[model samples]
Target: MSKQKKLRKADAATIRRVLALIAPYRLSVAATLVLAAVTVISTLYAPVLTGQGVDLIVGPGDVDFAALITLGVQLLVTILITVTAQWVMNLVNNRITFQVVRDIRVKAFEHMQVLPLSYMDAHRPGDAISRITTDVEQFSDGLLMGFTQLFTGVLTILGTLGIMLVIEWRIALIVVLLTPLSIFVARFIAEHTYSMFKVQSETRAEMTSLVEELVGNEHLVRAFGYESRAEERFEKINLDLQRCGIRAVFYSSISNPATRFVNSLVYAAVGVIGAFLAIGGSITVGGLYAFLNYANQYTKPFNDISSVMTELQNALACAQRVFDLIDEDPIRPDAPDAKVLPHGAGKVEFDHVKFRYVPDVPLIEDMCLKAEPGQRIALVGPTGCGKTTLVNLLMRFYEINGGSLRVDGQPIDTVTRDSLRANFGMVLQETWLKAGTIAENIAYGKPDATREEIIAAAKQARAHSFICRMPNGYDTVISEDGGNISQGQKQLLCIARVMLRRPPILILDEATSSIDTRTEILVQSAFEELMKGRTSFIVAHRLSTIKNADCILVMKAGNIIERGTHEELLARGGFYAQLYQSQFARS
Candidate 1:
């Protein structure tokens, strides 16, 4: 964990790439562009009409009342037309924006399914969520407000400049000279604002991760008396978030005021130059008035252009984050020609396998194991000796660093992930149930399970009695992670879930380790029934629970030291025997 790499700003190529998402709505985009052009033309007409009104009112001849009324009506008509065109443009722009956001959100989520478990293990849940929600919303605003405004503002600026030249070329030249300076200043502000916004997005994501972790593990914090420590950590992250927010707003707020100041300078220059030209008889007084009106109109589009530039930079920062996630290569699956496991008397073999969660520190090394259908294999090892790691590999949660694992004489890697996982049922030390009825939680794996089948599975796991005793019986709603239930009951519900699945291969990773002695006896009996005809791998520290396993493996460090039946291993007077004596003998 060196500081997570900062995302690059949205460059020209990135903007073009994002715009391509709207390709399917080309018709709507074309309509918007057409309306924008019409709106710009209509907006220019008002200045010309104002100039006509000025000349008529300040007469060198008779004052024409009819001409004044005509100019006034034409100006009113232009305003009405410009407003209508803008309304149409807004509709089209919002439609494209919402559609693109929907597409990107879907693509991001769908791509996540193919990514390996390792990627998820390395990233926080809140960071991933921010990419989907906050990042996508920013993209929407960019598409809608940024894209629409930038396009229309550029067209308006060009159209207004052309009209200004036609009215009085000297004034137009002054405006043109000022254009380059305004653009340069706008670009400078945009660059600074973009950088700050990117930092702010990252800090916000970090803050979200902290909050999600605290809320998800509130029970652990309370149990460990860590509330004060948690609060301190939260305050630190919150302060950092506040600082980033202030910096981003400070940079963004500078663009508008600076653009307005430049526009004011251009307007004052226009008034002075126009007055001189009018007095010198180089231009008509009416022409000078129209030129001034056009100058004011011209500055508006430039102001809008600068604003859109800032928004585009912010949007690009958001898009960069989302694209980074979408570009991650998902774990490669088996080739098309890979072998498929054949139906048989289920057998699992691990040959010379080696693994490490971290490089250079092996958790399991040169390990080999075999179990035929209906065999119960118990793995007995100290806390750090990799019992759960072995089970994880068997379930394909991680790929092995070396060696081979096969099921039914076919390499595990050759089988499709879906097919491989469909053959196993697992129960962990800590059981998890969703916020649903007890029946729904039990029938999760088999969603189409009937009431009779649900009841049967519950009965098999010895959970039916307690479930029946509840107020709602089988329909009792289990709160988040089954919070309404006791630890033993939750384990029983998990047992029922796996039993309902009824896979050929079963794995119990310290499944009985958390239950009381009485509940353990009940669960052990139910487990005995479940293991009758499956190839079962059980990891347990409690020796009594695994005494009847067909093969008992005693492991230390990263290697297995002894392998025998309970009686044979006890008679050998080895580590297994010593561990057994220390526990069962004392009892």
Candidate 2:
């Protein structure tokens, strides 16, 4: 309904989720609470002991030496216990806070792995990275502050109030009357600032995403001469973040001073009333002194808590982002009684298959095809003609909207996704190589492959010569995304990875597009060897690449207009022939 109501609901949910994360470490939490209590009790009792010691000295010589000595010893002991408990409590709090944060980050990452590709396509990589990293760090800082400061503040406040009442009800009543002022001030500031802090968190995520996008594509920005425009764009986002941050801090900062001012009034009232009570013999000097100490102690936690509230608000906002990631709906699970696809003949059938990325947009409709065992089915088409989409469907990255896709006569949906995907080796035009040695990259698809196997695969992909030239050869470590190597090298590594797997089916989506013509010919020969007996689905824009394919399906606007051998399609003098002629036509 209202923003306030929404904020309240969100805060409640975040707190509940945070508590759930902490639940597994309940023993540590319980210990922290016990130590907090012990710290507070021992701390509060010291003032009483001090007051007694003060009363013990009527005059310089009128002091009771034996009794004063014992009081002093007891107060010393109480202070030591307070310090020790507080130190141990901090240790437990640190452990619990960090452990919970670690769990949240882990769960968020695990969830991301199972999330559908559509989810990643819909969200920015930078934003997702921010949630698991920057946001989680913020959440950790906030949780730690709450554990270290907020708990102690609350316990101190309650403990002091109880001790104050016992020492002098009249002065304690004054504090009780003024207590609501501090709370109201903190609550008023907190409610207004929570929304601002949430805005700040969102803005921070946007900045993170922008920075990542710009930095990762700096070459493209420079190539387009967009340096000035890129700077302007970045400045705009940074300004928004600055504005949100400033407003959030300005509003949250008000609570501390506002609560401090209220608590000061409470403190002054207690001191004035306590002094009069001592003067009129309504309370002892020692008792009045204890009441004053309790009054100050009681009010100080309000100040500490008010400050902690600002941090908690920011923390809760960040926690909400992380929890959102953790709660995202994962990819649809495999069917009940789903069987693993056994390694059989590579016979794939698409029967009246229908699909679309968006429900309202028609992409592939009533599409049907079949690949007998060991046949190479090349998909040639214009951009957005569903060539790549077709390959994605075969891999089950996206399920067909209608009709059945079968691998060896068994409907693919009936098989576990892992098994179905395991049967196909894929290499796309856009290659991915993790930060590791060249050998490790080649052995990615088959982690248990031996050194000889990795070397053989690399040689097959025409990458072994280049690999051997590197300083460390197979052990040379590559930077992230293989930035240390050429694009062709990265693609070769990817191809080598797939070759190592040697799956029953292959999907090469412009897999050799990055290599030079000479290298392409070599890799093509390798592919010919690799595809000798496997059903291959090749998505290519270059007509020459698929000229020798067993069958070429020429597609346009989401439908296949022609399908036949390359020679047969060309002889038909149809769409396929026109496309082939256009590719090699004289200028």
Candidate 3:
């Protein structure tokens, strides 16, 4: 299809989707339309009343003073009703616009929860945030403008035309024939500006992403002396946005004046035709005056609509982005008869698993492992050797291409994901703590945990001493990401969270890497207590920490190169020994 045809098709689809979203508020929409009709009809009747008053005042003292006074009162009542109805209509429009925006934002966020991790890895978080927040705000503005102006404009035009035709059909026909000129000009300019607006929206999203990235990593930027480079990068995107914005605004701005010029011609035609008719005595002077007023009213809507076309174009563009996010493919759902994972001895088995992120580029191929009940399995590997990938697959964060993973002899996929995940507790190298009290952070996995239970878990994770040192102890509030605490303290809080869960299986991926050597010794002892009789998988680089593990698996390039006890691996003098010696040699 041609580009113009495609844009028109997309615009139609966007309108349909927006209408679908607004379907629940049909009653309010109907009320707004009724109010608009009342407002327009009242506004049109005022001009008719003025014309009658003029007719009553004929040739100085020949005027009917009583009739003029009555008409003036009627005009005043009509104006008041018009103002009141318009005010109510605006309130309804605001409610609908903001409600629609809220629904869209909420729906977008809900969809994000189900979206695949790969989707998140492939897109910038700031861009997603912009679509939900910034883009939705833009859509609300456009929707409000359309509801406020477009509805009234259309009703006014139609009402004025009907009134004009009743007084004088000839003038009405002249106005009708000339009015299409305004529409044609508006359509031509609006079509050209739509693509520019789309470009501008996309550029704005890119700018948002860049700013978020730079600001979030401000410390790193300055520490690495990257301020100048960062500024240059930001300036480049800023310039692109400026150029796109200017072109869009400039093109859209042409629509208003071009349509206004056409409307002016229609008004001029009605005036000249009405004058001749009144002079020829085919119409009363008062009737001719009302027709001229109706003619101006008929053309005024076109100007109002043309002026709002720019906002509508930009709104539709942003709406499309939001809808695109809502329509992203979510993670695959579980089977119809998926069962909840039952609590049992943790026996995890990976049977000939094969997986890769990019097609045809193998990362973990033909991998097989089995962890028996109450065993501590340690995984040691160089970077990019599929260590963390194993943890992700175990947690079902990503599906393996060819695999049958089982937990306690039941296929992992046979159980609901939430149920399967509840069987394991995880603590990672990167710690995360939401803004809350230290006790709350510790009891995150178990919200109903008591204060005593929270304190006990903290003690088990070797974090209780530091927790007591805080100003309010367990009651003290911390910021998100634990900005007020040390990195070691944050890691301890994360460990305490897992301790509180006490799941059947545990996955510790460099869980103690952030702590100091002294604290590491204490936390490691606590981990030993936590791991008793529970299946644990440890991914670590420091070989000393795993010296007493039940089994150690040395990995290289997605395959296990060695599996044995620490003494057995060292006696063999293989890759494991070299890796172990390399770390100690550095010390």
Best by TM-score: 2
Q: Candidate 3 has which clashing residue pairs, if any? A: none
**Predicted candidate 3 versus true structure: per-residue lDDT over 432-481, tens digit per residue:** 99999998899888999999899999999999999999999999999988
lDDT of each: 0.86, 0.90, 0.91
For residues 330-368, write the lDDT of model 2, one tens digit per residue: 988999999999877999999999999999999999898
Deviation in Å, model 3, residue 329 alpha carbon: 0.8
Error of 3 at 127 (Å): 1.1
For model 3, the local distance difference test gives 0.91
TM-score of 2: 0.98
> Each model's TM-score?
0.92, 0.98, 0.97
- Number of backbone-clashing residue pairs for each candidate, in the order shown: 0, 0, 0
Rank ordering of all candidates by TM-score, starting from the highest: 2, 3, 1
Error of 2 at 140 (Å): 1.1
lDDT of 2: 0.90
lDDT of 1 by residue, 93-132 (tens): 8888898899999999998888888889899999988989
Off by over 4 Å in 2: 58-61, 64-67
